[model samples]
Target chain A: MSTSHLHPFDAALALASSAAGLYTGHTSPAYWNMVGPFGGITAATLLQAVMQHPDRLGEPLSLTVNYAGALAEGPFTLQATPVRTNRSTQHWTLSILQPDAEGAPVVTTTATAVTAARRETWGVGDMPMPSVPAPAQCKRITPAFRSEWLQRYEMRPVSGALPEQWDGSGDTSLSQLWLRDAPERPLDFCALAAMADIFFPRVWLRRARQVPAGTVSITVYFHAGSDLLATTGSGYLLGQARAQEFRNGFFDQTAQLWNEAGTMLATSHQVVYFKE
Target chain B: MSTSHLHPFDAALALASSAAGLYTGHTSPAYWNMVGPFGGITAATLLQAVMQHPDRLGEPLSLTVNYAGALAEGPFTLQATPVRTNRSTQHWTLSILQPDAEGAPVVTTTATAVTAARRETWGVGDMPMPSVPAPAQCKRITPAFRSEWLQRYEMRPVSGALPEQWDGSGDTSLSQLWLRDAPERPLDFCALAAMADIFFPRVWLRRARQVPAGTVSITVYFHAGSDLLATTGSGYLLGQARAQEFRNGFFDQTAQLWNEAGTMLATSHQVVYFKE
Candidate 1:
């Protein structure tokens, strides 16, 4: 397909290899958040660099990304290094850099990823997918916020949602919703990584106050492979997220994503920084 | 206290600074596992390097460690680098290296940590500590295995015990227990990090088979700071762990640690590799 005809998700994740283990990418206005590009898109783009590397070993098993600082809107450079490669697994360290006003490259993000050649074995899903209304039955939510990233996905809330009053009367941080790409892109590892961060900050829901918050670090464990993602193509995923504790200007939320077939696709946990 | 009089946990975590951001440490026989030292102690020791670093910005906010390979019994070198330091937050990258048979240093583990100068803010805990008997009321477990690490911690299981029969008829992977250092060491961040990994591989509990399994990557999010840990003192921590999904020779477990007073201390998640 022509570059212009490609889906927004694909175009946003496009990367060019300038040198070995080095990539240059641009920020997509389509996925812009309040401050910068969506954190999910940035995470997926970083994973894309490793996935595109010739030296990469099998598929992604786990990924951890830490946002050191918000990226300014512009082009950025990414470096992915394979620190250790074992017989069945490979470990990588990655970073994204953008030139500051002084025209010097500055690190804005850091990440570590583990990829492995997984083999079939005994498997089970202990966290069963909760029964909820089908996506077609639930009303799609259109957030009133101006974040461009929120408009790129179709969200249908099943439980916890954004507070209507913002009066600090929230009782819980748990949020459940059916979500998928707005333009309906097929499922893939990069897309799955992005989808894992679809949930908004849990603190906003827990406190019913619009506190300033952003993810400091996020870790995602992939339970599905390429074949599984293909089988779940273009389908709505049920996502559930909840904060365990919010203390000392920080909180953590754990989330699980399951496909229409009830297969658990991924589980993610993140620590967020919040200002009162 | 003299070196000889130090607690085993302290002795195991002792580090000698060889240079800036470089530390030399030895494995303690008290915490040895099947092939090497327990993963918990190794994780705790890695965190110690940053904690003791002169350039550290603040307390740990999050830590993710990837186990590339097992450490050989003996001495190892650790290098911690402050990749990005902001006004209130600092990001670090760390690795542990051990000499191979060829007398060349090789990387065996890699980690990333975030430390921040936290401030008081709105706080809440959604995951309440489950009701269970006090530590004195529960009987301690004595496993048939001969791993030295098991003897270092006093574990009182409240549920999800190891299978008595290996007939492949296992069920849930949830385990709740009261844990504390057997020698009665006070609680700290390092101790809490180690306790996060105290639960055995959840697969063994989910399935009735003793399979070969090890943690591939683990991430711990700290909710309590020095003050909270000090308040916890030498008291037992009630830990709960459960597997969300087990598939394709890999599974992830989520855990929470709470002090006797029902104060949530930390939450941890890990992805484990298993062989059929």
Candidate 2:
């Protein structure tokens, strides 16, 4: 029950409820991005607020997070409102607010999530896991960059590694890799949500140019439930990401995560803002 | 302007302003689905509210709509709130409220959209348009079902046509088609948004079983601007869609739209609830 004993992932997601649908949380240095905390962890924290809500229904089926603005260091207020609850599904709208330069609370992030009581049904995985060398055979990426968030994830790039040369001549944008939490945390909806955003901007690799890029919006669809995630445990997940188009200072990329057992756990898509 | 002179698409999206961030709209029979107005049209209507807003900034970058409940055949109240407005992008939270059986307004649909002033930058189309016959060469599909919405689009399926049998024996879920407005309306974001959801439930095609299915959440990323869309005019767009996974009564699919010149227009993804 103590925050000190929790994993960094859980610690970063820790929230204290002061009123109905209102939660207070803090940023973690371990998952800090260039300007703020990683968007994925922020997404997970918002989902955690909803998960802890007393009026929560079922589990997370889909989540969309919008990074409206940068989150400052220290505490922020998150409001998770269940906008609608149906017989089998519930919809939630969440927003995170932090003080602006003018000493007024302003929205830093916005999100919408759907929770549903899943039922047994005919199941199928249309995308087969990409064939790649096992995690042991892959070389772990040692970040030369200053992103604190990179150090939080144990990533083994199988292809499309950050450009060996930033000459702006790259042709392909595809990247397949094995990834997991650095400290080895068990898989869950929140953690999976965080992992869904692990891929760096696909434009960087596709153009082989070191341009500024950040995720503007990210959406994740969970295909597996708690049981399957529990079974997946702390194992490395195979992730493949690629961009469909990069135009007008924006690009969208989609990625899929699968367990070592080759079962697809989640699929995620994001639109990124880039400066060329 | 009178509604009678507007195109059917514009007529279906017609909204009457009541107050700041609030409007009222009715479901058009021209875009009616099996139980309600087509989900794509509903999405476009919500986006339309923002486009018509006095405080709206820039063009649409991304939109995510959650179908919280079935929309009845009547007028519904729509609220579009710009929760945050950055220098380049604006975030909006929108919801549709309609009277339930007890005559009290309830949330029927909820959505979030981002509008941004796009800038010139390095651009590329990573996902190539699949080579297919021109719209003139492909045979236009005649509706075999009673859904009024089917008649609104002129579809020329190149692959993954609806099953010829109702037996549960199917293989792949990929569908490629050339689609355009039935009455030859000009290309625009609203019509493109509606066309994004034109693909029928992939589960039916993948399983060859006509099970009940409906979209729960849909997200679209706009890749082309109004200028480019205007260049596209009323020509058919090449669309390709496929399901990634189906499990626990839900499945997620991804789709891409491109012009005849091989330029990617938009990419859309959705999570659908299906009963098997």
Candidate 3:
């Protein structure tokens, strides 16, 4: 929305309505409002709507949603189609539609999913668990200071989020935390996807530099031993993510999850955008 | 291919076939020859196949292929399908089929493609550039030195690839070089993806520590500029990429790309599977 062509109000109203349609797809707004505006989280919710829960050893894959357009302020509509559901992986396509004006079309984006059964290949790729005792024993940092948007999830930092150390006194630049599916819904990889995307600014200590806001998109590869103990509408969540990339305005992070025992679990990636 | 499985001939045949099928989705001894037991290069090739090329700007999109399974002796078949082609973004789905002789299926993986008409975003993200004037100003570290890879891309070392002092004159923790696309190609985002993946090993002076040999999968992402100008790529693929997380045989690197103006051209993220 710009003055070069369209009025701001016209664009905002149009975006709001389009956001409703874009967020919910062809469905009503009430359904999608429950689906947040965060593209990564929204993508997770879309995956949840189509793919059935993986039963005992059942690997019906649910298609994924890729955020083609950066997440902006407004409503969004999502469209999903089931391609095939087999024992190996459930496949589908999810589309996100961004609205403009009454007659103007919004940005539409989609992704295909392929969930498969667990197999062994010795991906052999595992980062050792932190030397820290536990998330409970770690310090606690208030999220309100940075993310007003993270209120949707119950976040309890394990290492309490490290402070900005000028001389690099930190032993580890990583952080860990436990969370609950807010609104108490069954947790899935979607939740993990959402959780990883928001874990950035938290990991990058706010050392008095201006927060350069930008967009982020993530790709998650769920491997064996990665699953949630949290029930769909109830349970606890554990998020172990480390900020590894913050070069220029582009940042990247990889996160892993596990119930306990330090067992390796689902791996997720987060790409954060920065505006200067 | 397995021993407890079906025909040995079929398994052996698929092994070679899958390797060749990786690049063109057609099996041949030529492609297989290009692929080897090296997982790092193999993974990079597979990612390139799935990545959307710039020449295909107006064509349909596809995921190309992702690492389904690598036996180090993989007969991996990479398959891709056009998801959809639209005015803005094109999507694709790619599958890598890993065959098994005794097992039902060795490995199956799929990835989504988001191909969009890219726009130019101008920025000088405060990143520094190497002092190298251009590729012509840089000298290739001879192949006689047995650095074939380094020769392909012009590496103008800010500090000689060797230690200045007997006790190690410079920071062993870091090294900077000017590297560019050799001989020039369509220099687009996919190539940008390729550039990022390869720049990691150069981050540190090869301190008698085998780098690439230990690296596994280098997952690279580009958040911005796509075009690799004949001059730009000719000047400096300047800047540096550093490892952020390394544990349990897997390490990750985040790369920052800078132009001669000290402007940030793009950013890259990659996960490397390697051992210390």
TM-score of chain A of each: 0.98, 0.98, 0.64
Per-model TM-score on C-alpha atoms: 0.98, 0.98, 0.51
Ranking by TM-score: 2, 1, 3
The local distance difference test score of model 3 is 0.43
Give the runs in model 2 whose Cα sits over 4 Å from its true position: none
Every model's DockQ: 0.88, 0.90, 0.08
- Across B56-123, the per-residue lDDT of candidate 2 in tens digits comes to 99999999999999888989999999989988889999999999789898999999999998999889
Compose the digit string of candidate 1's lDDT tens values, residues B97-202.
Answer: 9998899898899999999998989898999999999989999988658999899999999998788888888899999999999889899999999999999899
Which residue segments of model 3 deviate by more than 4 Å? Answer: A1-36, A52-65, A68-76, A82-91, A119-125, A139-141, A146-149, A160-173, A182-186, A202-210, A224-238, B1-219, B223-276
Candidate 3 per-residue lDDT, tens place, B11-97, comes to 222322233224333232221322332222343344455452333343112222233333434345655444445455555545555
Model 1, chain A: how large is the TM-score?
A: 0.98
Consecutive 10-residue window with the lowest summed lDDT within model 2 chain A: A1-10
Q: Is the docking of candidate 3 incorrect, acceptable, medium or high quality?
A: incorrect
For residues A1-276, write the lDDT of model 3, one tens digit per residue: 343453211121122123222334232221122233545555555555444323223332222345554434455555555434444334444566665557454444555544555433222232445554554654444544434345555566775364654442333435577665444455455555555454544223433233444333455544332343332234444567654434434444556654445534455655454443
